[model samples]
Target: MFTKVMVANRGEIAIRVFRTLREMGIRSVAVYSDTDRDALFVAHADEAYSLGPGLAAETYLDVGKLIAIAREAGVEAVHPGYGFLAENAGFARALAEAGIVWIGPPPDAIDAMGSKVRSRALMDAAGVPIVPGVTEPVADVDAAREVAERIGYPVAVKASSGGGGKGFRVALTPEALPDAFEGAIREGERFFADGTVYLERYLPEPRHVEIQIVADDHGACVWLGERDCSVQRRHQKLVEETPSPVVSDDLRRRMGEASVRAATAVGYRSAGTIEYLVSGEEFFFLEMNTRIQVEHTVTEMVTGLDLVREQIRIAAGEPLSVAQDEVRPRGHAFECRINAEDAEQRFLPSPALITAYREPAGPGVRVDSGVRAGSQIPEIYDPMVAKLVVWDVDRESARRRMLRALDEYVIEGPATLIPFHRWLLRQEEFIAGGALHAELNRMADAPTPLPPADGAAPAQAAPGDEAPEPAPQAERHFTAEVNGRRFAVALRYDPPAGGGGAGAPVPAPKKRAKRSAGGAAGAGGATNEVVTPMQGTVLRTLVEVGQQVEAGAVICIVEAMKMENEVAAHQGGTVKELRVADGQGVAVGEVLAIVE
Candidate 1:
């Protein structure tokens, strides 16, 4: 084993790698941006280095700076943990040139599978089932149309060099092709610096299944099994599970073999995931992720393999620890990406400080979190705060455990997808494992968008001043009837002329009232109830006495997992009262304001 390893990443993945390194008696080094000076991972590592400013381009993405840091730390190897520089082939090659160990696949393997276009051709040549489409970048709209015609309608225009669901568009009909092609090309250029794009037949209602493969430079390789990540939004995975409910044992073995072949074709070493789009019994290769995955925790839970450890050993020129026959994926495992997002609001990012951090625990539950109480989630990176994983003897037990874990998870900062996951678990189609990728969209009750404030308006301010003027009050009364009873709650309105509360006095209850009585009694005043739209801490309350706000206008921001999401009014209303102040911890649906 190497004496020390520099982790070229941040957040939960950094911490995860550090923990494993410690277990293996290897020293771990962490690099962080300015915004992450106080991050949990920094403290977890044996040594740490600053990587400049908060933005990824300045910090994590700065390959030269990272290389310099690794040299300064005297580390034998650098571990790129999944994102940022993890999949950057140039970074891998640069490390190798600098005489430092790169804990991932060979640069050639990354280059082979890095480009979607190249990967498709390679897979095709290897006799792998690939989605029928253009093998090369389309020449023009006419060329694109021809490819679409051959591939059939409902094709996707995808950037040749793209990931994270960016630089891709779906054309449902012939009329949508031109725009889809152009938009995909534009996004491709902006996101990847590559305007080249190709066409592929879009598989509607497809299940996102991927096979995990581990290889040693000694020509030994084994397939770990399969993970289903169909639960996604905008092509980004939200939840991933192993031993897919949709894939049979025989199908898994077949896919595993194909993945091994793909890896073998490239002389792949280290841990990599081969992603595939599965529709019914038919499976098609998507692309290969040539690094440890965010959802690797689920695979670990089921396979009992320390994938990072294996990656480290492989980098050290170690042989495969287990043979292909010994690698068996037993039981079921699920990983919920505990992102700083509001599931109700189309899974929008919710970034805020973590005031109270409560992780779920019990049988078959594991929380990989990179945060602690008082941690300020920076807004310059991914929104994933943690990963909640659970394992059970079977899928049903795993589902039940996941539901219980989600319910018990107490993150009183940015809003999270706990409720959304809760709703998904209860869904009949989801429970039956019949819910396809598009079925979630077709479901009627996709958790109503966060309810709006009753009578809130935006605040405006004079030039050169900091605050915007408080919203003017509306003369509408607000009432809530919970459980059949009605209560009189006061709704405060904007002040008259001198900037004071002159419209209505906000009623203050001496003690907590009954849920039914509280809802019924509050008629004209702002109620005490303030629900947070997502998991995160209250950064600041942008409202005060006599301030008014319109429905859908931002009332406050709850930061979770380092992203600031605007908590908007669900309905037009005036500001009743600011319930939480700056730095207050809040849970999802833990009322943030009572708009009247």
Candidate 2:
């Protein structure tokens, strides 16, 4: 086994891998940027190094810098805990050249499953089921139109190398094909540095089910049951559970068998997942993730296995410890991703300092988190603060247990999904068990309930009035450069209730429905000011200055925290003035346009 390992990612996954390394008596290294200098994961590492300061591209995604750090730290292997360079085939090759073990599938396996287009063709050749669509990249918008007509409308335009809900667009009509085609290509190029795109039949309301399979070098591979990730928003998974409520014994067996075949076809090794879209009795292929998944925790809770350890063992050339028949799963597990987002505000990213932090404890409850009091939820990375997971004898029991745990998980200083999760758990749609597309939409469009004013613990928002946090009780930031290096310093002081100092906590924004003329809100409501819900870059503007539009028409697209949010007109008429343009940075509640 390797004596020391470096984790090339940050936040909870970094700390997660460090815990496993510590248990195995292996030293773990952590890499960070200026923004993450004081992050909890950095403090948890046995040896830590700085990756310099800038966007993710300059820090976490810089393969050359990462390899140099590994060499300096004298680590034997590097483990990418999902995202960043986890599935990067070129990085794997570079690591091999540098004589460092890449604790993941071989470069060949990654390359085989890297491109969505190629994987579709490979799966079809392997006789595994696949969605009916083109295997090759479409040439242009005109070409995409042809495929849409052939496959019928409501087709999906996806990035050739997209995953985790990054580069996907849907066109429900022929008139929307051009924008969808262009958006897919643009996001593909921006995120993955590849502008290639392809089309697939969009299953409008299919359950997002995936099978987890691990393999060793000795030709031993087995599936670890299934995880239903149907609870999602904008294609990003929010809730995941093992032993899918919809998948039956016979269906699970078939999906498992098919997953093994898919792995074998690519000569895959290490940990990987085969994601599928299920409708009624039919399941279609939806790309493969050639790395450890964020939801791997749910699988671990059910099967009593440590997937990270398995990845290390496989990387060390060890054979499988348990055979296929030896795999026995017990209990039901559910994982709720506690992201720094406001469910009432269209799931907008709400990055801020966590003023207070606490976790639930008891039997079968675990909180895998990377933040604590004073931890900064940086906007430069993913908005997820932690994952709250629970296990029980059955799905119903697990659901109730999760509710209790969610109530116990305490987070302050940002809006979160706690209230929405509590609400959804009690809903008939979730309790009865099935796909939750319509129910999720309802929650997404409606306002999340506020905590009762009787001094009870808050499940979601902080205790404040209904308005944008005024300039603060006062939190101010400054940049300090010492000896040629820069540092970001933020000093905040929130006084006791009546101090009325500069840093008092700001009131939560009001519900979207109550926005009157001239006031800042998430959306345009009793007024014509089309406002953005969060701070991000304007990816596109759909309408012109004088373009006539209908109520609820999409006016622009904003990219924040790696997710695309559409800014729509509350009561559209004519776009009298356009205040923003494409590729511009926007602030929260900033008006994008004025429709009169």
TM-score of each: 0.77, 0.87
Backbone clash pairs for candidate 2 read 473-502, 473-503, 473-504, 474-502, 474-503
Go through the candidates in order and give the C-alpha RMSD of each one to the true structure: 12.0, 8.6
Residue 410 lDDT in model 1?
Answer: 65
lDDT of each: 0.76, 0.83
- Candidate 1 positional error at 153, Å: 1.1
Q: Alpha-carbon error at 391 in model 1, in Å?
A: 0.8
Those runs of model 1 whose alpha carbons end farther than 4 Å from true positions after fitting are 442-447, 450-596
Across residues 146-167, which tens digit of lDDT does each residue of candidate 1 receive?
A: 8999989899999988887778
